[model samples]
Target chain A: MSIQDEFSFINQIKPTTVHHEKTLITGIGDDAAVYIPSPNQSQIICTDTLVEEIHFTSQTMSPFQIGYKALAVNISDIAAMGGNPLYYLVSIAIPSSWSEQDLIEIYAGMSELANSHRVDLIGGDTVSSKDSLMITVTVIGETEEGRQLLRSHAKSGDVVFVTGTIGDSSAGLELLLSKGRHGTFNSNEDFLIKRHQYPNPQVKIGRFLSKLKRVSLNDISDGLASESNELAEASQVTITLNANLIPLSKELVSCDSEGAIEKALFGGEDFELVGTMSMDEWESIQQDGRLQNLIKIGTVSSGKPEVLLQLENELITLEKKGYNHFKK
Target chain B: MSIQDEFSFINQIKPTTVHHEKTLITGIGDDAAVYIPSPNQSQIICTDTLVEEIHFTSQTMSPFQIGYKALAVNISDIAAMGGNPLYYLVSIAIPSSWSEQDLIEIYAGMSELANSHRVDLIGGDTVSSKDSLMITVTVIGETEEGRQLLRSHAKSGDVVFVTGTIGDSSAGLELLLSKGRHGTFNSNEDFLIKRHQYPNPQVKIGRFLSKLKRVSLNDISDGLASESNELAEASQVTITLNANLIPLSKELVSCDSEGAIEKALFGGEDFELVGTMSMDEWESIQQDGRLQNLIKIGTVSSGKPEVLLQLENELITLEKKGYNHFKK
Candidate 1:
C-alpha cells in the first residue's frame, strides 16, 4: 500500500482500549511503543510466524481465521511459559492481491481474541510482499517474580497432564482439506473443522499451573510425540505416555480409531497445554472445579531423555514425527 | 527446514554474550524468553520487516548486508526514541532456493551489529516460504523513566537539527542501480554503494539529545520531505526548512548538484536522526565535541500543520514525495 494508505489503515485499526493503561506510556503512532513494567513482575516474550501457502491457504482458512491463528499461536507460547499476555506486535507483509478490507477483517479477528484476553495491540510494521501474504506476531507477557514455568523443571515421578483434547485440530484439518473427496460435512466434521480453525490457548490453566511448585509446561504445537520428547529432553527424564489415557475429542474419536490415534500422536497445532507436576499438585488440580478437563496422560521418570508410548499390548519408542517444513 | 534443522540453526546463532545479565531471566531456549525490568526504566518496542525483491535484490545486496540492514532499521527506530536497545526477536521465512549457509551468513551480519549494541537475541520463528524470503525483527529497548522523545513534542520557536549527511543512501542506490549504464565503479561510486548498504543508527546522538528538554525526534527513513511533513503534522506546527543549510555529504555533492538535492529531499532509507529543540539546547549541542556533525535545518512555528522550503531565490511548499510501496 501507499504510505498514506498504510497510515490510514493503521489509524482505522488502532486499538481503542488498553488493558494496562497506567503502565502504557505510549502505544501506536510513535516510532516505538513505550510502557512501564511492574517492579514485582518479570517479562515474557515469544514470536510466531504464519505464511500463506506454507501454513494455510484460502481453501483452508478465511483471512479472519488466519489472523486469529497467527496471534493465537504466539499467545500459546506465552501461555506455555505460564505468563499473562499483556501486549503484542504484528508485522504483516501484504500481497497485492489482497484488499484493505481483507486486512481489516484480519485485524478484526485478532482484536476479538486480544480484547477477550485484555491484551493490548501496541506496535507493528506493514509492508508489501511479492507473491504471498505473511504475518509474524510477537507477544509480551508477564508473571510474578520467579514464578514462570519452564520445560526443564519436571522431576522424576511427576505426573504429566494435558488440557482439553488432543488431535482434534489435525482431524479438523483433514476434514477441511478433503471436504469434496469425503462426500459431505457432518456435525462431527464441522466440529473438527472449527477445532482446527479456532484453536484456543489455555492461558487460565497455564496461570494456575504456574502458581504451583516445580511444574514443567509446554504448548502442544508440534504434536504429542514431539512435545513429549522436548519436555523429556529438557528435563533430562524419560516420559511414558499411555495411549489409552490420551484425551481425544468425541469428534476426533468418531473417525477411524487407528487414524485418530495416529493423529493424536503425530498431528500438530493443537495449542493445548501439556505439563508435568508433582502427584500432590495433580491431586489439588483434580479437586479444582475449573480444571475438570485436565487429563492425566503420562509420567516422568529419571532415565535417558526420551519418549515412549504404552499401547494395549505393546510399548514402543515414539519418534519426533511432527510437521517439518524442509524435511524433504 | 525441518524442525531439527531449525533448532540446530538456532543453536548455531544463539547469542554468546548478554549485556544485561542480571535482568535476563532466560534466553532462547524454552517456550518464551523471560526477563526482569528495572523499576526506574520504561520499555520501548518496535518491529520492522524486509521482503525479498521489494526491499532488496541479490543484485543490490549480499545476504549479509540484507540481514544487517534489517536489524539496523529496527534499531534506528529505538534510537529515534532515544532508548537503549536490549533484546530482539527475529521471525524469518526462508525460501527453498536459499541455502542454510546463506541463512547463517545473514545471522552473522545481524549478530555483528547486535553484539556491538549489547542486544540479546532472545527468541524468533523460522519457517519455510514458497518464493521470496522475508525477515521481521522486533526489538525491545529501555530508557530512563519519563524520558522518551516523541514526534508530537515539537513546539513553536524550536530549532530543527539533523545529524550527519542526508541523501547519501539515495544517491548510492541510484549509482548501484545504474552501474552498468555508467562506467565501471569509481571510489566515489563504491563509497555511495557502501552508504546504501550500511546505514548507521544514531543512538549516541539520540541519547544526548534525549537528555535535553522537550525534544521532538524522528528518523529520516522516508526522506526529508515526507518526514518533515510528518513532524509538522504530528506536532501541530508549521516547519520552514532552509534549503542551503541541509547537510550533504561531500561525496554526494561531488555528483550532479540538482539531482543530489532532489535525492536528499525525496529519497528514503537514510537512517539519520532529525529533531527540534529550544535554541538554548541547540547551543548546548553545538558546544558538545561529540555532536559537531549536527546541522540546523529548519524552524518550527505555530500555524496550520504544513512544511515549507526556503530556497535561495523563492520559497515554496514542500511536497511529501517519498517512496511509497504501492503508489502505482
Candidate 2:
C-alpha cells in the first residue's frame, strides 16, 4: 500500500468513547486532538520513551515484542499511580529499509497487548531514521475522586508491600549475556525470558489498592529497593525491609541468590508494584485473600529514610543504587 | 533530588482549561493516571516521532533547536485541526554523553515555546540511547463546544483561504543547506533561516476560524498544493487555485522570481492554515482586522479533487507533488 493510505488508515483509529453530552471537540485526524478537561476528576497524563539500545536489543527480540514491551512499560507506570490506563499514543522511528511487513509486526505487537488490556491507541507519529530504532509511548489514565494514590501520604510506622516476584528481569538478562548475546538459543527457557520480553503491569492490583484509602503506591520500574527509597523520601520516613520476606524464583536456587537479591532490589525495568500501608490497616492486609501473596518487604520508620536488612539477627545496610537515565 | 521532589515540580505544569470540567480524574506522579471517557466530545489523539539524521541533522542543529522544533511541529498539528492547544507530554532518548547543559537548553527551548503558547507540560519519560537522539512530543488541544472544524465539512462553492506565506520553510531549508555546503552565509537574511529553525503554529487563528459555521480547516504542514487536495478529497469536490493571489515570500521571490511560484506551491513545512469558507458570510471576514491578511487563494468545485492554476488567463494544471513522509 502507498504511504498516504497507511497514514489514512492510522488516522481513522480515533478514541471510540462517545462523548456526546459535554462540549466534545476534536480527535484523530487533526494535528492535535483536543478534549475538555475533566473538571470533576483531574486528568492523569504520563509519557515514556524507549531507546533501542537502552531498552531493548532488536537483534534478539521481534519487532512486535519490542512494541508490546514499550506500551506495557509505560502502562506499568500508570498502574503504579493507581489509575486506569485508557488511551496511549506512540511515536516510532525506524530505518528506511524497514519494510511494511516489519511495520505491521511492530504495530501488531502493540495492538495485541493494548487490545487485551483495553488500551486505545489514540494517536502517534512515525518518521524515518538513519541507524537504530526508537519508540516512545504516552499513556493517559484516570482515577476516581479522592482514590488516586500519591507518595506523600505514607506516615511513620506504616508498612510497605510489593506485588509479584522481582528481579527475574535482571536474572533473565544475566542468562542472556552469559549465553553470549541476543539470539543465544535457550530451548529450555520459558517464564524468565517471557517475563523479560512481555512483563505484565498489575493494573487491577493497582486499582484495587487505590481504593484502600490509607496506602500510598508507586511502581517499581527501577526496582524495589530504589523505589522504596523514593517512597521513603517522598513520605519522609525510614524503611526497614525484612531480608527474609523478599520473594525469589525457583531458578534462583544454587545461583548467586545474594547477587540476584541485589539485582531484584536494585536492578531497573522489573515493572512491579511497591506500596505503603498504614500500621492499623497493615494487620487487616494479612486477612485479605486477594492480597495474600502481596509480600511485606519493609516498614516505614520514624528516622531518616534508610533500608536495612535483618540478616541472622543483625541489621545490615542496603545501598540505594538503582537505574539512572544518564550515567557514564 | 528525590522522586517526590520531582513530582512536586512536575505537578505544577498541567493544563487548566474550560474542558477541565469533566471526566479526566488526575495527571502525573501517581501509580497509574486515571481518565474517564467523555461520551460527549469527539476525542482525537495522534502521535508523531522525529529521529536524528532523518528529521534533522545534529551537525546543523543544537539540542535546543531539536527540542523546540519537536513540540512546534506537534503544535502545528493542533493548529491544523483548528483547536486550542492545552497541554503536552515529552519523551526523549539521548546518548549518555549528552550533557546536562544540552538537556537544559532542550527543555528551555521546549518550555519557551510551550509557555508562549500557554501549553503546560504535564509529564514525560527520559531514557538514554547508544547512538543518536530521538524526541517525541504529544500535544493536546481542544475546540470550543460544537465548533469543531473538519475536512468532511467542505462543500461545493465554498471559497478556500490560506494564511501566511507558503514555501518559506523550503526557502529557509535551501539557505541552511547552502550555509552547510558553501561555508558562507546570507548575513542580511532574517525570516528565511528563522522559519526553518522555529515554525510558529497558527493555533489562535485556527481556533478563531473554527468559530465560523462553514469553516473546514487543515494546516499546511504538507505543501499547499497537497493539503488542498486532501480538503477536496475529504469534501468530495474539485479545487482551482488563483495563482495571482497565492501568498509569496520575498525570499522566494529573490530566488528566480518565476521559480518562486513553483516553490510556494509545492515546498512543505510552512505550518500555515488552509481552509474553506462559504460565500454566505464572506463580507464579515473581509472586514475583520486580524484576518484581513488571509488571502483567498482558491475555489471549491463539484468535480473530483484536482488542482488548476490560473496564470495569465490560462487554466493550467498544477499537479499535486508535495511532502511524502515515507518517500522523503
TM-score, each model? 0.97, 0.88
Scoring each candidate complex against the real one, what DockQ results? 0.70, 0.47
Please list the residue runs of candidate 2 whose C-alpha ends up more than 4 Å from where it truly belongs after superposition. A1-28, A34-39, A180-188, A254-258, A288-293, B1-46, B58-60, B181-188, B287-292, B311-320
Give residue A180's lDDT in candidate 2 (0 to 100).
33
Which whole-number lDDT from 0 to 100 does residue B153 have in model 1? 90
Relative to the unseen true structure, what is the C-alpha lDDT of residue B63 in candidate 2, on a scale of 0 to 100? Answer: 72
Question: Which 10-residue window of candidate 1 chain A scores lowest in summed lDDT?
Answer: A175-184
Report lDDT (Cα) of residue B100, candidate 2. Answer: 57
Candidate that scores best on DockQ: 1
lDDT of each: 0.87, 0.70
Q: Give a tens-digit lDDT track for model 2, residues A1-328.
A: 2345446546544444533224334444555555554545544667777666666665446788888888889888878777777667777777656666666777788778887778766567777667677888887766666777777678878888888778877766666656534555443244566777788988888888877867788887877777887777778788888867777676553344567678788775778888888866777766665565578877888887667777669897666667665542
What's the DockQ of model 2? 0.47
Query: Lowest summed lDDT over 10 consecutive residues: which window, candidate 2 chain A?
Result: A18-27
lDDT by residue for model 1 over B287-316, one digit each (tens)? 775455688999999999989999898889
